[model samples]
Target: MKKEEKSKPKKMKWNALVLSFLILLIILVLPPFAGLPVAGQRALAVLAFAIMLWVTEAVTYPVSAAFIIALLTFLIGLSPPLHGAGGLIGTKTALEWSLSGFSSAAVALVAGALFLSAAMQETGLDKRIALLVLSKVGSTIKGILFGVIIVGILLALFIPSPTARVGAMIPIILGMVSAFGLQKESRLSALLILATANTATIWSIGIKTATPQNMVGLNFIEKAFPYHISWLKWFLAAAPWSLIMSIVLYFVLMLVMRPETKAISTGKDVVKNQLTELGRMSGSQIRLLIIAFGALILWATEDSLHPFDSTTIVLLVVALMLAPGVGVLTWSKVEKLIPWGTIILFAAGISLGTVLLKTNGATWLAKIFFNKFGLNSLSIFTIVAILTAFAILIHIGFASATSLASTLIPVVIAFVQGMDNPGTIHGMGIVLITQFAIGFGFILPVNAPQNMLAYGTGTFETKDFIKIGVILTVIGYALFILFSLTYWKWIELLP
Candidate 1:
């Protein structure tokens, strides 16, 4: 009886949830009544609700995403009817719009990528690669850091999921550190893990299929505009940025946390022993290696050498990976290993962003911002910088780079359209850098999916993340602006 009384009192205590509820109510009721178009207002209302849910996380991300589909399923009548599907708004039509995100090929790519990551872990292929690279890099702290980065780049090229990449790297790298008598919380441990985390995100912009967010941005362009950015073109524009940023990332890590012990001296021996323990690759490992490399070859060459889209090629590889006799993964094994929640989150974010563009909600939001701030008189440089800042700073509210890009890429596009007297160079320069910069999330654990995964390992604290994050974020943005003026201008791509 005493315990029950105490529990009842505890449950009765006030929480801050009432505020979120009030905010949600205001969004739902007031937006539809605003001077927005019927469709725009409804889309805006849905966006507001999504923002609240994402910020509070009162529910799991997937649940909140599911809520979006549920709400759109019922309340879609408030918006203008979409064309091409009976040319009217109805529950059926709304459901289709909401479900399209869940069904997008980008989401499938992420799912397939997850299964492939599971394959590496199950077949011990990831460990073998890690050991092989670390072994060749020698015993110096700098060399080992580079080794960790090399593993990250190699895995990231094929593994689209940052969480999956980090998931694979963490165990192998941590095991290696353990082999060397390093503690998880030490500077070296932190450096190694941070290198892994940093590279996982850094490579997102380098490869077309490297991250879902990149695809999300592409989706926005297709939905909002008539132009196309091919997989090869995206890589062409971003490869240099990625290469330079990678060098910068490595330098930043070295500058921030100079290891007390300059050289491990035994790293080679540790690598030798780890490789010896791993033994020769199994048949499954060899098969997975071939499949992994094959997928890479197709993705890299598809734009020039073939007609299939990136997603189609990815799905083909996935089908091959699970084929009965030649496959690397069993359905039973992948079913358990896939990050379904993230897949759902990706779907929801894409859906919301897609609907926002469809309903003209993104355009309305931009006009509102411009009117409120009197950005009407701003130059293209100022406008692009503000948008860039928004693109980067907005990560505070979202943990997934995919979600952040989906939500803001459309906004960035709208702002680009708003610019006046923009020459080809200025407009394209601003647009490309603003969109490309969205791939990076260096601020908080919730800023990037990988950050949260790295935080889970308990190797580094929030403070550790902030210091390095600031250095990278600042330099990254600065480099972006400088490149726009120099290299990008010289190449005539911006012009």
Candidate 2:
């Protein structure tokens, strides 16, 4: 009886593994039949499978992404024998294509910004800045919400990763809320703050290296447009919308959470005291500030000079931190600070995206969808925006913005391309907006790191999240469409 029971369990386990593999196979094989090329379709299949695994926690997110990369290289190379490598090293061209993102100047810029963010955190400069802002803006709940938006915007310029920025800010925001005697789970306030921070990072998208998706958009623009917008040009074009959105968000928060003046004023002294405790910026803070600003200047002007690339600049900054005079940053300390999972996941995502594009699967998908739908650029924009907003509604189910971006951007891009617009570059605005909207997953604690962090403070509830999040979503899409029609035209990036 014992032996029979054990055998039954073993059989069940085997059946489950076989079922999983079959599902993956079906997903991978189906795309080719749907008019996507085999290699590209297979890559999509691998990505879909990987995303499922990631969402289910069957494997870590990074692990799933990495596994997809390996599967793509093996499968794509074997079928086509990419440049005669016959699946060993992969076709030389395939290897080059897969690794292209690593060599991109934008990736280096983002990586550099990450290092700078780490340095700022190490010196406690970011915390000091947050306290300073809170002291000045903490007299009202509305003011504090505005303060969070302001702080998030400033941080976005320094911290490129939304996840990192939100993770860094949540503790400080929670502390302020606690001091105010506000319920941490109060849906309106907490959810608004999360949305504000995520929205603020959208402003950074105006800067060339502010986010990896920005790089992807830039790459697409260069490919499709006769003219390339420089970093300065890009910033000038998008900053106005960013500023407008930030202000709108501030008012929206106030409207949703009409907390009484007494509640708003309750925590003023606590925040003020925290400011006092930080005292003045120390020498280390001052030095790190100089280094941080210096790196930004270099990054902004990277395309101007032919000297060093963005990655080298980051490596140099990291190296300087190890210098005797700098003393604050050491290799031992700095190495431990890197978000290694993010880097690996980023590399894998870029690799997989490249394979999908290279295999002609993206193009093939584009052809079929475009042929049947007969949509123009405007229709494409509307559809993409609507779908993106819809995805934001369910975003809590996904783990990271990057994961969401990686999975969806390709499909959207293909859809836009299928429209076959002469002003295809204009489609980039849709891509940028979509990436930003993914940050809208504010209704659920699991939607974003900041949401999760704030959720745990026990002041807010799921109902609060849903209430505030829905309003933000409505307002955000309105702003997105308005920006798409007016601001994009003014910038001449759109017709």
Candidate 3:
């Protein structure tokens, strides 16, 4: 039985890889349709190949990214250039375009953010902060649950990576469960763990740097539109929606997955003991806190207070944190902590999206999509509802919010650009709102890395996750519409 289980994954990968190659061949060979340029047709084919590989888990992300870059170099290079006096883009120039995403400031910010997450982990600061928050919340189950959300919110501000924030909290939360003498699978355990996972997702909606997907959205927005979304401006527009959803999360989880007891009488003591085990805060922790806090201020005041952008600020923070005699982490230690595969995949995704836009593939596809749905004739409110629903439903198949955002945001930008709205409907607003829906990975453990991290604790069943997840998804969708009609419109995010 164990042998069969091991072989199953190998078989699945072979099948998926075979299917991906077949799809790529068909698209490349099929006669052009929709008046798509030769380069555009080839770009769409590569995109379909990527989506299939990504959705099916046919290969590791960095491996798949390497495949994508290679294919783009050859396929796009062989096709006629989109413009200019050239027979073909040529493999040399095509490779350059394929690697262009590495040059983006978004890529730099993501790398810097990863370094910060590493520092938090290396110095054990993330764990200390989480335990400190729980220690102060008292022993009541309700208080602990609320504290989990609070921890998520606070960490999202300081830690830019969602997985790292949730990663830090999971062990501490499980410790609290053990301290209370509850079984790992107890209702109380499930409740607290689920809340921790959901809170991480909830707070990510508000903070621009909390997740990579938000950066993916910003990348597309900056490339396709004439707008620049400052950090403060993003907070002003999206934070209220996230705040309301955070409240909704508390109520829904409380009602659906009520714990066996109202209080963990020893919860506070366990947390206190854990905090005591660490003794006093170290110099490393204090220095990291100050540096992170200063960086946060710079990010929040990007456009208003000074001229430095968020990416530049993060780079500077990372440099300071790694400098000799002044930093919390060394290069060798931090390098292992960072997921270079994710960075490679991130850069590849940006390059693919840029190619889609540059070749007009996204525009052509968007036109067909809008016309098929008759969205072009609908009110902006109706359009938002339809698009947001599409975003939510499609998330079921995506394991990475970053992949979803990269694959779809470019098309969404093109969709908005093709519309007739001049000023009233801001493409940035529509893209931003849609980006929020892309974070709705509540339906399954496989929907996100954080969800999977929590699920691996074995404190909750799949059915339990599904039940609470369904509720969260519905609430998230409803809240999305509510904000669209009221706050989003008042703030000029919608029509």
Candidate 4:
């Protein structure tokens, strides 16, 4: 009884980690016992273990990735259908399969985009763009909020990172709001901060490369469906809805949190003063602007004007950003700025997803769950509505969008392919829908990094965030259905 009391506190202290660890041990036994094929069983163990670790965060993101590599190599290394031999697979072949994620072009695109996002920070180009937009939006409080949304959507295109954009813009927005004599506790301040976070989050959908999760989704889609999404192609399909969603966010905020004052006459002056202090654009800033637009033009036109893929274009852009004298940043500056840990885990996620599909693990899991939900007979629209709503709502438990995606997307693909005949469903629009819905998981600060940053500003209560975020998520859901019925149908991505 004394020993039990002592262990109770210890187990309570770890929350889900210890429990998840035990569950993992039990999960590894199920596949073989349940008569799953050897490779599929091994793959199932890896997928279950990875999802548990990701959700519990018992291990750091990169450590979870390392666990994935090590676990796969150990469990399925010698499974049947050897890669290069007549019998069991060799260590070399197993190692190659385990590490195949590093070879993905999508992985490279993410790494290069991170470097480019770092360049914006290195050159203060993001700040320049924010200031430039704020200066143009005029003195009205409404216009300033609109300008922030404009910057969010626009920056999301070239930056390819919502967190980076949030880090650069939050301080500036808060400072300007303070300069306007708006108190931090004021409804206006909370609304503006929430607006910025929601706008940035929404942009993740419209631009495929804007967040690593979107890229992860595309990678999963390519594996499951035949259609490939291009940079311009994604923009045309989802961008308009982002604009409409941001506008909806703005009005929703106004209706819910009526500001203390209707207008801030000093707001324009505040932004103009900041720009004046910045003086004329520096040489590095100018060079960065040129490169930024150069990359944008290429990204938007790559499908037609250039034969190279999006990853190749991003690689070229990063090269120009680090080119000795002409470059805006150096190796020393960018090396520390890039989040290599994120890159490691994201790369591992692609590999994990690939393993799930190749080994039939994803399909098997899909069958089990689809059977439980009776989704097999539901219409495509009904399934999508349910799936998208579930995706958005499920974000409440996740603290990282990328991790949520790495875990959810494989299951989503399986669900889509679960119908009586896979031919009965088009399978094209589901990925796009998943991309849009997943980004709207803002019911709490833990839902996404942008929300966490915005929450840190201390302008809003958790209750207020939940109240506003849930409404916006619902609105975002409706927009997804509307776009599916209209824009996506016109584009032939959906029947």
Candidate 5:
């Protein structure tokens, strides 16, 4: 039975691998349609294969990324040049293009952000901050819920990684429950776990550095348009939505998954004990706090108080933290801890998006897809309604928001660019709006890493999660459209 159980996954993986390659072959062998340039068609084939691999978990992401680069090199290189005097683009030029993502400011920012997350982890600053906030929220259920939300928000600001923030909170929440002698499957456990995960998801919108999905969208926009959404600009435009959603999260969790008790009574004691175990703040924690706050200031005032972009600011922070005397972390200590595969996957995703633009693959796709649905004739309001629904629905199949953004943003950019400008409609604005919808991973445990983390605790049944998620999704969708038509329009973030 054990052997069979293991073999099932192996069989499934093999099936997915075959299907992905079959897709690539079928697309490649198909004659160019809709005037898709040879290079563009090849790029699409590579993209489809990568998407299948990503969605199916047929192979590890870094392995998939390596496969993508190799395919792009050969497939695109063998195709005719994109423009002017054509022979072959050649593997040399194609290889250079394939590797271009590593040089992008967006990719660099992600790498720097990972380094910062590692620093926080190594210094235990993230845990101390979370515990400190929880310790202050008192012993009531309401206060604990509020503290969970606040901790998520605070961490989103200081720690750039969504998974890392949630990671820091999960064990603490679990430990608090254990310390209080609460059942692992108790309502309070479910409520706290869900609250922690959902809070992390919600705040990913308000802060630019909170998630790599934002970076993915920003990357596509910068590659295709002159507009640059500074950290402040993004926060100003999106924070209100996140703030409103945060409130909704608290109430919805309270209503749908009300805990059995009004208060843990021992909540404060448990938190205090945990804080005591952490002991006094170390020198490393103090230095890390100073650096984190400094970075926050620089991020908020970007492009206004200084010309340094978010990427530059992040790189600087990383450099400062890694410096000999001035920094808190050593390269030798954190080197193995850093997720190098994620960096590779991020860079490869960027490269794929860029190639789609360079070869006009995205443009061709946008035309076929939107025209088939008659979306061009719809009002901007109606168009957003449809697009956001599509974005949310599509997210159900993707575990990584970064992959979702990579696959969706380029096509969205192409679609918006092809629309009637009307002076008010900008691809960047529509893309930003759609990116918000992409963050709606509320409905399923597999939808996000945080959700999966919460699910692994066994505190909530799948049915319970779905019930609450349905409500949150509906409310969130309604809020998304409302914001798009109201605040986003007033701020000129939408048409």
Candidate 6:
């Protein structure tokens, strides 16, 4: 019996491996015969092959993605516009286009914001705020859920990147959960916290420093539209929707889990005791708060002075927080707190995007869809919104949000032009919708770093994520479509 069981598994593995290789061979050889652009076909084939490896767990997801990037860059080089010797070396024109995204301003801004988030986490400022909020409003499970939402929003303002924000907050959240005795079987409690944190990623789209995708949106709009949407205006347009979605998410969580009232009581009493243990806020905590608020003001008003760009303001804040006399930040601790993988992931995404756009792969794919469907501007918005939701749903196969964003943004921009009003407001609307939709990755343990962190606590199951995530995703998409059509018009940003 034991030998039979072992042989069965071996046979399955051999069959699966053979099937994958055959499928890969077919995709590689068939696309050229189908009259597809060689570069675009090759890019699609490579991406499909990577996805297959990721799904089968043949290799780690990031490793698979990295492999695709290397294969595309080295094997194919430049396609079509510069063929033969020109293609081998890459055309001067292609170099100019691809290198443009490597802007010093974008890199500095991202690094500075990352440093600030690390400083906050290292100094214990985020924990203090979480404790304070829980102490004030966590008497009930519902209250705790609301508190989580508020804390998540505040963190988003400072952290910007969801992976960083989620990672930094997970340990703190787990500490609180453990204190309250809310374990994995307490499904409702776990789902509520995860939903609050995940949904907050959408709200961060309102700020320039929120994520690299926001910056990409801004750059695309500046190039394609006659006007620019300021950070404040973008916030105004999306904030109401964010608030509404958060409330809906809270209620949906309650309905799905119907957690026993007893679970709420266990955590409340424990949290109160922990609050007593924390005592009053320390001097370091107070200073960190001031630095955080000051940084926000600078970011909000970055356009005012000629010399003070978003990058400069963020760097200044990081410097102040890290300064020796400040005592709020320690070099040794901050070094440990920083998420180096996230930074590298961001850089790689940017580089890959540069290659795609330079090689006209993005445009080629866009043209295929546009010609096949005959979609106009409004139709394009609908298509993009739907595709964005689907992308988020299957994002477990993706290693990083930046990776997903880099791959999708160009295609999104191509569709945006189909809209009659592809100006600042419409552009902002599309960007916000895509960013928010991407956060709907609630199905698997590995979908987003935050979900993975939350999963690690052993307080939730994959099914728990699916039940709540599905409902929230539906609500999110409905809200996105409504906001794009009506609210944006009321704000005079959409046609």
Candidate 6 least-lDDT 10 residues: 82-91
lDDT of 6: 0.62
lDDT, residue 238, candidate 2: 67
lDDT of 5 by residue, 1-495 (tens): 999999999999999999999999999999777678899999999999998998888998899989999999999889898774659999998888898888888988988988888988888999999999999999999999999999999999977777788888888988999888888888998998898888888888788899877888898887667788898999998889889989999999899898999998899999999999999999888888998899999999998999989988998998889888889988898787688888888899988988888889999998888856898778878888888999999999988888888888899888888887734335577777888889988898988877887788788998888888888899989998888779888988776
Score candidate 5 by lDDT. 0.87
| Candidate 6 regions with alpha-carbon error over 4 angstroms | 1-69, 76-87, 91-104, 167-184, 187-192, 199-229, 262-269, 304-307, 330-332, 377-399, 418-432
lDDT by residue (211-252, candidate 3, tens digit) is 888888899888767778888988998788788888888888
lDDT of 2 at 203: 59
- Point out the worst 10-residue segment of candidate 2 by lDDT: 80-89
**Candidate 5 residue runs with Cα over 4 Å from true position:** none
For each candidate, what TM-score against the reference? 0.90, 0.82, 0.98, 0.92, 0.98, 0.80
Predicted candidate 6 versus true structure: per-residue lDDT over 1-495, tens digit per residue: 999998986776556556655665676677362444565555565555544554564544445445655656643455554232443434454344434555635656677687777766666677767666766775677787777777777777877777666665566666766666656456554765566556555555444566655665455445545664555555777678777877887788778766666236566666667667768877877888888888777666656543376667777887887788784777787778766555544554555555555445566666666545665534545655565665676565664455566666666666565445556556656655665555455556566666676667666677877777777667777877787678866876555
Q: What would the per-residue lDDT of candidate 4 be over residues 85-152, giving only the tens digit for each residue?
A: 45664456667767877888888999999988998888788988999988999887788788888888
Give Cα distance to truth, residue 409, candidate 1, Å: 1.7
Give candidate 5's error at residue 338 in angstroms.
1.3
Question: Tens digits of per-residue lDDT for model 1 on 345-385?
Answer: 88888888777766677777877876468665776556656
lDDT of each: 0.75, 0.63, 0.87, 0.79, 0.87, 0.62
Residue 106, candidate 2: C-alpha displacement in angstroms: 3.5
Enumerate residue pairs that collide in model 6: 180-267, 184-459, 377-418, 377-419
Identify the runs in model 4 with alpha carbons over 4 angstroms from their true place.
1-15, 31-35, 78-91, 415-425
Model 5: lDDT of residue 268: 99
Ranking by TM-score: 3, 5, 4, 1, 2, 6
Candidate 6, residue 197: the lDDT equals 54
